[model samples]
Target: MTTDRTNWAGSFSYDARRVHAPRSEDELREIVAASTRVRALGSRHSFSQVANTDGDLVSLADLPRTVSVDAAGSTVTVAAGMRYGEVCRELHEHGFAMHNLGSLPHISMAGAVATATHGSGDGNASLASAVSALEMVTADGELVTVDRDADAERFGGMVVALGALGIVVRMTLDVVPTFEVRQDVYEGLALDTFEKNADEIFAGAYSVSLFTDFVAPTMTAWLKSRVDDVDPAGPDPDWMGARRAASAHHPVPGMSAESCTGQLGVPGPWYDRLPHFRLDFTPSNGAELQSEYLVPRAAAADALRALHGIGEHIAPVLQICELRTVAADEQWLSPAYRQDVVAFHFTWVRDAAAVMPVLKLMEQQLAPYYARPHWGKLFTHEPGHLRSLFPRLSDFRALRHELDPRGTFGNAFVDQHIG
Candidate 1:
C-alpha cells in the first residue's frame, strides 16, 4: 500500500496505480490517453486530496522550461511545472518580479495559479491574478489558450480549477518592475493591536505576515516592508530561527521542530524571497493536522478575538495560528475571489478524536462571518457548506462542464466540491 499511495499532511494518504513523467504536451497526451484516470501533481505541497489518483499519476517534471519575459508587455510565459523559486529568478534576471510569493519556493507556477494560491499582501491580489493568458489541455486533449476578454468566464473559473477541468500546461503572468522588501518580528502584543493598525500595517509595505500561537495571552507579529519605501529593524538573531525551525520538542512554539513552514521573508535575491518559509520539517515529534479559514477582512479583529477568547481550550492542542492577507481577485474558486480576505491557519497536535470537537466548535464560531475554507488545506466545510462560500460556484461548475463534459480530469475531490 505504501507503494500504491502518496502521503499528505502525515495523516492522510491516497493511491495511484502507476506514475508517469511526461516531457512535453505530446507525451502528456499519450499518457492521458492510456490511463483510466489521471491527476497532475506539482511539488506535492498541498495537504488536500485534489491531486490523488488511482489510475495514473502524471508529473510535468520533464516539461521544457517555458519562462519568457516580454518587457514591452510586462508579462512572462511559464511552463506548467516551473517552480516558484525558478520563476522569480528567471523574472528577476529580466528585471521584473512577482508582487508576492507564498512561503514555499518549490511550488509550481501552474499548480499555484491553478489553485489561486497566493502570497500575503493587503493590496496584493493572489498570484493567479498575474495571468494575462495561458494554456490548458482539456479532458479530450484539446489545447486551449484563454485570457481576459477572451473566454473570460472560463479563464476566471479555471484560475482555481482544482484539476477538475483539465491539466494546466502553460501560463502567462503579469509582472511589475522589481522591488525589495525588509523583514522584522515583534513579540507580546494583544491581538487587538493588529486590528487598529490593520490598514496602516498592510499598507506600509507591498506584503506582510503575522504569526502567533493562540496559547498565550499575547501574540507576536512579523512585519515585512517594501525595501524602497520603508526601513525595517535589523533581524534579531533570537527570532531568526525561532519561528521557522522545527520544534525539537512536541508542539511547542518556537521549538526546534522540522521546517513546518516552507520559507519566508525577502532573503538576499529575488529568487531567495520566493519561498513562503525557510524552515524544513524536523523529524516528526508527533502527528499533526491542519485547518484554515478565510474571513471577511473587516471582521479579522473579531475573528482573532473569538479565537483568543477561547484560547485556553484551543491552545493546549494548538501549534500556531498563521495570519495572512490578500486582495480580492476575479477567480471564481479563489477564497478571496471577489472579497478581500483574512486567512487563519491552525496546526493542531494530531489527535483526531479529541480535535474534531474543537474543529466543529470553531466552525460554528466562524459561521456568521461566512468564512471560506482553503481548497488545499484541511477543513470541515463539506460540499453543501462549501457551496455557500463561493459566490461563483455555479459559474465555475458550468465552465467545467463546457471544457470537460466527460469528466476526464475529475476525481472525488471535484465531485464533492462542484457537484
Candidate 2:
C-alpha cells in the first residue's frame, strides 16, 4: 500500500503518487498526452473520489488567473481553475458579478460547474447556466471550444461532464452589473412558510437558501436580492430570526463546515452573495461526506416533509441540509437536466459505513421523483439508473466517443456513468 499523503475531502488522505501542479495549459496537455492515466484535481472541495487517480494527478493551480471584463456585453472569461471567491472579487472590481453562488467559495469554477453546483432560485439555473462558452482539452490533447449555439450537444455534456470528457481550461460566463444584497435571515419560520409561499419567497430575490435541522419548528431563510430595490431604511436588525448560537458553533461535530460568520451576519458586498465563496470561516481539518439529490421543483415541499420524518436521526451526524433551486437546462449530465429542480444536500461526518444506509433510505424516500444525483458527489445508483436519470444521456455518450474515442479520459467514475 502506498503511503504518500495529501489533502482530499478536506483531510490529509493517502494516495499513491505526489500530485502535480502544472503551470500552463501546454504543460497540462503534455502531461495528459504522456500519462497512461490521469485525473484533473480542482480545489479538492468535492466529497467523492471523483478526482482520485492512482496515477498522475494534475492540479490547475498554476493555471493563469485572468478575468476579462466586457462592460458592453457584461461577460467575463475566467480560468477554469479560478476559485469561486476569486472570481467574485475580480468581477466586483470590474463592476459586475454572477447571479448566485454555492454556499462556499473555495471550490474551483470548473469543478462546481462540472457538478452543476448551484444556489436557490426558482427562476435561476445552476452555475453551469452562466456559461456563454468554455474551452477544454480533449482526450487526444486537442483543445476544443463549445457554446450554446456552437456544438450545443458537446457543450451540454461538458457543462457538467464530471471531468469525464476532458479538462476544461477556461469558461466565458455572462455577468450582470455589481449589486448589493440584503441577507434577511428568518429563523424558526413555520414549515408552512415553504409549503405556502414557496413560489413567492423564491421570487422575492435572485436567490434564496433554506437551512433546516428537520426537527426545528421553523426554518431559516436567507433571502438574497439585487440591490436595486433593497429597502435599507426598514427595521434591519443585525440578526433577523437568528437561530441559537449553539447550533452555529457546533453545527458539524468535528468537520469544519465553514460558518458564514465572516459572511452570514451582514449585507456586505452584494457581488459576493454566494454561500460557497467565503474562505476564512470554513472548518479546519476534518473529513466530510456529502450526498445531494435533485427533485422536481414542485416536489420540494413533499421532499421536506419526508426529511422531517427522519430529522432527529439525521441531525446527530448531519452537518446541514441545504435547499437550493435550479431552472431546467439541456445539459445531459446536469442534475437539473430538463427539469426545474429542487436540490437537497446532506452533509455527514465522514463515516461511509454508517452513512450508506441513511443515504439509501433517502433514495427510497425520494424514489418517486426520478431524482438525479450530482456528477461529482456521492451516490449508489447503478449505470442503468444513471442513464435513466438523464434524457440526453445517449447524446452525451455520442459526444464522449467523438471526443475521447479511445476512452483515454475514462476512470472508474467516468466509466460507470458513460461507458
Q: Which candidate is the best by lDDT?
A: 2
Window of ten residues with lowest summed lDDT in model 1: 240-249
**TM-score to native of every candidate shown:** 0.87, 0.89
Model 1 agreement with the true structure over 149-258: per-residue lDDT tens digits: 68764678877888777677888888989866555454555556566766665554456666678755555555565656653544443442233222122224556424
Candidate 2 residues lying further than 4 Å off, grouped into runs, are: 1-18, 235-265, 280-283
In candidate 1, which residue ranges exceed 4 Å CA deviation?
Answer: 1-4, 231-252, 256-267, 274-276, 279-288
Query: In angstroms, how far off is 276's CA in candidate 1?
Result: 4.3
Task: Give the distance in Å from residue 68's predicted Cα in candidate 2 to where it truly belongs.
Answer: 1.6
Query: Which residue window of length 10 is worst by lDDT in model 2?
Result: 244-253
> Model 2, 1-419: lDDT tens per residue?
11224554653352426577778888889888877667777777776667766667777878778888888988899999988888888788888878777777778899888888887787778888898888888766778888777776466777877777788898999898777775555566577867876666566566777766656676666667655666656324433333423223223324343455323434667545556335665545547788899989888888878877776667777777778788987677787888898888887778887777787777777888778887666788766677887888878888878777777666676777777
Residue 354 lDDT in candidate 2? 77
